[model samples]
Target: MKLIEALPIVLSCQNLSKSFRGRHKQETVVLADINLEIRKGSFVTILGQSGGGKSTLLKLLGGFLPPSSGNVLFNGQSLKNNTPDIGMIFQDHNLYPWMTVEQNVGFGFRIKGEKPGNYKHLVHEILDTVGLSHARKLYPHQLSGGMRQRVAIARSIVVKPTVLLLDEPFSALDVQLRRRLQEFLLALWSEMNTTMILVTHNVEEAILLGQKLVVVGSNPGRIVEEMTISDIQYRDRYHPDFLHVQRYLESVLEGNLKEQGDNYYEEVLAISRIQKINS
Candidate 1:
């Protein structure tokens, strides 16, 4: 692992485990014996199959969900509950219907007893930064999907959260929009320097957005693979180096899912269409 110099470890988990009771006291484990560390200003992506406990792990790290065993530490302190220093963006933007763009973006500050006069400049600055200044007066219903998501990002980040946890924020958007938003997110990360951990099922998207990618396997979920891609050349989607990483991650996820069943063959077919196979 190529550790980023001068960056402090902002998040850490040790021997994490989460399970739930189902079917007459049958314990169904989601994640077990998991360990991970996220450094300040790092972009980490979590990839796995549908039932592979990807989002569950994110919740655990963020303290939105408690682990059945072990613990998660935020900046060397145990994370007991959701903290303002750690922000979260869900798949759904969840903007209030009546709230304007600026209102939604500054909502975090308002809830914390911060007057609008204090956060007014910051809200406008973030709105203009995300290219949503013109729509600041517009409500959630008035904005398009991409614009709404931008608002969501602005909302989570305006408060200057130490770390941001995103649960597949762009999964609902179409391909082109998703890429555009991905670029937008990268720009935000560059400017804000917030440590981000994103959970997604899209291998290509994961490869495009993350500095470090972690693959989680099902049946008592655990980290099966981890890769660090700091070289900018691999960011190009069409580059062989980029495709090689994508193919490798797809193969890992496919092999892990194949044991579950062949019913989920669409992923294999989609990957095969992009990658040539030796006959």
Candidate 2:
């Protein structure tokens, strides 16, 4: 295994920001000055509340949306536009209803104008890698939520993009299924060595998957805290250090409950004002 520090930065974001037009015709900022670097083959996870700008950041990195300020760099070039070097998987399966699992997995290659025969072996290999070999002929509707997600993952990774962006990919699965898929993804990452950025609301999931965990908040969504999980003892989620970090993050989000007297109203009003303006 290559030392983490020796891995080159595969993606970078500098002073990234985004805003939406408010109902009052003012700009409601969702993110501001977001700077991040994803090392080659590293897994970075962004975790936040439901309304936080996690999804927006993911979209920006994936080239699905333009940043209001700053730039995203892929390799050494500015990501001023979309490119095939990035691939994304959303919460939705997003497979063509008419296409079989094999076809969907090969869709990226097909769109690139590659002949089926050229990518046929690769597609089969990825399907098996994702443990979906038995259901290669199934369609989206014919599969369970977990299975569909596996197909989506297969599709994204089949192209072997330099970076993979995922937005809550296993959010719809049951607890057991989600855990299973998480293990599968970690194993797959070990084998393929792909750089990945995942946006999720699941704290445990973030802790388990990320080499670094970024906590984001809404209303000019900026990173509030970044925790390195490299030393986390994953085998014992209940370990003292693990619990301590979890509690720290939870407190960061909920604020110090004991000090909610005079400052509570101000914080409440700040949130309310943003919502009223955005609404």
Candidate 3:
């Protein structure tokens, strides 16, 4: 999706870094000197290899974890820790099985001590946005995996946070379901105009869903490449540009792996040459 215009800034990060303790007590850096700026109402997807700092970065932004260095800012305010302005959705629904769908969606308000009568209307509205209105009374166990995920999404969005952090939230679904939910998410984002950052290893999804695509990898997870996803018309997945972006992203991801022996590097160079030729 090529952006026709520059969007307003909704979130920013500067010199963000994080590290974990290794088995030998060595400091294992997961993210290093990361910097990012997220436009309000934009969809930003982070594509990275497994064990990369993609998830860790998401957690840091969401305030689920503290960054080792640098700063995260939201709307000129320092994000020293978690703020209600940020909402998070994980791969696991994390829905309370005992709570009904409506109850789950309204849980955030409840935690803040708001009366049910005050937020009940909003809960229903957000549920409808995710196409879960009819399932409002259903428990988590009574819903399909996709439906459960929708509930999770509704719960996060009901409060209308400025930024939404998604950690491979759709990875558990079937391919078709994943695509459907992707479209749903874009639609919701359009309607709500919420800034969103998602972590995923899926190249196609990253290219198709993100206006700004970032490739991250570890040994201290840092952004290796950042590219604007232009030329996507969203008309069809089989479009030439779509396939081209996917191939490019796949090649980049393959290059980030630990097994990039000489043969692998040569293969990658060959693929790059071929893609350049085709382009």
TM-score of each: 0.88, 0.88, 0.87
What is candidate 1's TM-score against the reference?
A: 0.88
Say which candidate scores most in lDDT. 1
For model 2, the local distance difference test gives 0.81
Encode model 1's per-residue lDDT on 80-167: one tens digit a residue.
9999999998767699898999999999999999999999999999999889999999999999988998999999999999999998
Model 1: number of backbone collisions: 0
59-175: candidate 3 lDDT, tens digit per residue: 888778888899888886778778888999975659999999999999999999999999999998888778888998899999998898889988998999989999888888899
Residue 111 alpha-carbon offset, candidate 1, angstroms: 0.9
Cα deviation of 208, candidate 3, in Å: 1.1
In angstroms, the error of model 3 at 172 is 1.1
Order the candidates by lDDT, highest first. 1, 2, 3
lDDT of 2 by residue, 174-226 (tens): 99999899989888887887888998888788877886778897676888776
After superposing candidate 3 on the true structure, give the runs of residues whose Cα lies further than 4 Å from its correct spot. Answer: 1-5, 256-279
Clashes per prediction? 0, 1, 2
